[model samples]
Target: MNLQVLQQLGMSERDITLYLALFQLGPSSIRDIASHTGINRGTTYEALKQMAARGLISYAPKGKRRFFRAEEPDKLLELAEEKRASLEQTIDSLKTEIIPGLHHLKPEFSSGNVRFYEGDDGIEFVLKDILATVGKLEEKTYSVFSTKSIRHHLYRPFPNYTAQRIKQKINVRVIALGEGGEDAEYSERKWLKTDGQVDASYIAIYPPKVAMISMASENYPVATVIESPDIARAQQVVFEALWRFL
Candidate 1:
């Protein structure tokens, strides 16, 4: 069997070894398990305790001694479902309790907090941050100065970004530098003349944060997220002015 998959499902090396040994030698004692797996008796006992606690194994007394056996294979699926439900509960707690408490500790109007991200995955991180921070307010909108260069970089990593944004009901106003972008629901686009100068950079103006993405790097894509209300407002004003002119 693929032991690595058991490890991925939160089983430790000792646990996997002991479980496999138990499966092979059905209704075995601790001495038999240790002898089969070449593990020390004390460690084997501890692993058996843990596995039994997790419902992966069970034991029943046979006269003066007890024999341990692996639970039905279907129990592994039940254990995985339990882990998934636990993880969902943790995520909910972090969102409702932990994250807001941490936010409260942040200084108001602090020096521009800038974070750098690299590669395609990093670019997707920045985009997801925008979607998550905007919340679900119908009137909330953000502005963007999008270029063809950055679009090419982002399209592959986040092909469904626009569809996800629309699904979340977030609105955007964009100024496309150097042509060709379609109008979508909850989004407005206008073209800008690059005048034979394509900078290969994109700017997104979301309140309290402004993101600048550079697709000019030959090696990989890069993104910078600046968290400063003043800077974001300034960029928004510039985008609005250009929006009016276009």
Candidate 2:
């Protein structure tokens, strides 16, 4: 009476009952099948016709009435195998259609462009890119002003990154906003008190190619990096002027 297997083979509840009755009772007319399953004659005929079309049953005329019998149960395995073959053919056709387009999707190696990355991962990408760009420079200087959220995320990863930056001998002059008030731990430990104090804007110079200017907040965390020689010179002049006084 475990008709769950038949139900899974695309048999409806009434269809399962009729098919199980036919399966158990052997070759029989729709009337006898209906009586055996207690299904109405109309529903029994419908289920019988559908099962016949699916190769689940075979029927032929015997005298004045049609007699129906369940086809070999092995047809269920054949149906599954046929579906598998159809799926494999579909997958192979798609592979042929898509593989050639992959080469066209490849980027040209010499092409340089500004790309926008989204969300927290974008922020991480920009920050990590800054680290890589600075690591190759002979000298690096930055005046960074950060908001609370940026400060929190920075603190989480700062220890390891700070160690890496220090080993590179990349001098970073940070100027972060004293947003969480005067005696913040990030300000005391990371900020250079006199030369590198907290401010409302961020400025950083890593010799040759990069500088990050970030204004971080809950709603608008904008980190902009200027990679032009002329702008780098302008920032350096401003940073040096501020560095000299402090």
Candidate 3:
């Protein structure tokens, strides 16, 4: 069975090894469990102590020593629930306490911030951020500079992106760098002719932030997000001028 979920629940490799060993060894002393798992006695004891603390393993008195055994696997659900509760409380503290305290850390003139993302998961984050950022705006519209070369690749990470955009009532204006893009609700498109497919890149001009996505290699995508109102505004101005000319 895949016990990888134990790692997600904060169990180290040694802890898992020991916990599983206890099931095989049946209520084992720390020394026997350590010998079975090939871990040192001290480390195995500490790991078992932590597991006991997490309620993943239970110990009982046996003669002069304690014997350890894995709790029923059902305890994993309890552990997961506890983790979720802790995360929710942490979220509350971040919003109500930590973030307010962190405001003083910002400089008088904040410089542009840039972040990089790679692969499908990273691309999904950028796309979700776009919808979230634009949705919070007084103007729920943004512009895109898309190339045919990368057009197919852009939404692969977020196939339902347009659906989400429309659901959120967010609109997009596109300056397609080459032919072939579809029309959708709350969107306008204009094409820019090129000799052929140039470099595969896409740029989105969202106020206060800009996202640039491109192909690093065949079927490989990378993205960069620049959080700067000035840069976003500059790109908007250029896009508007070209939009009118087109």
Q: Against the true structure, what is each candidate's TM-score?
A: 0.71, 0.40, 0.64
Tens digit per residue, CA lDDT, model 3, 72-180: 9899998888989999999999999899888667653444378999999999999999999999999899999998888788889899999999999999999998788
Off by over 4 Å in 2: 1-8, 98-246
lDDT of 1 at 27: 97
Q: All models: lDDT?
A: 0.86, 0.61, 0.89
Clashing pairs in 1: none
If both were scored by TM-score, which would come out higher, candidate 1 or candidate 2? 1
Q: Quickly count the clashes in candidate 3.
A: 0
Candidate 3 wrong stretches, greater than 4 Å? 72-74, 100-104, 113-132, 135-140, 145-170, 176-186, 191-203, 210-226, 230-246
Pick the TM-score winner.
1
Candidate 3's C-alpha lDDT? 0.89
Please report the TM-score between candidate 3 and the true structure: 0.64
* Number of the candidate with higher TM-score, 2 or 3: 3
When 1 and 3 are scored with TM-score, the better candidate is: 1
Q: Which of the two candidates, 2 or 3, achieves a greater lDDT against the reference?
A: 3
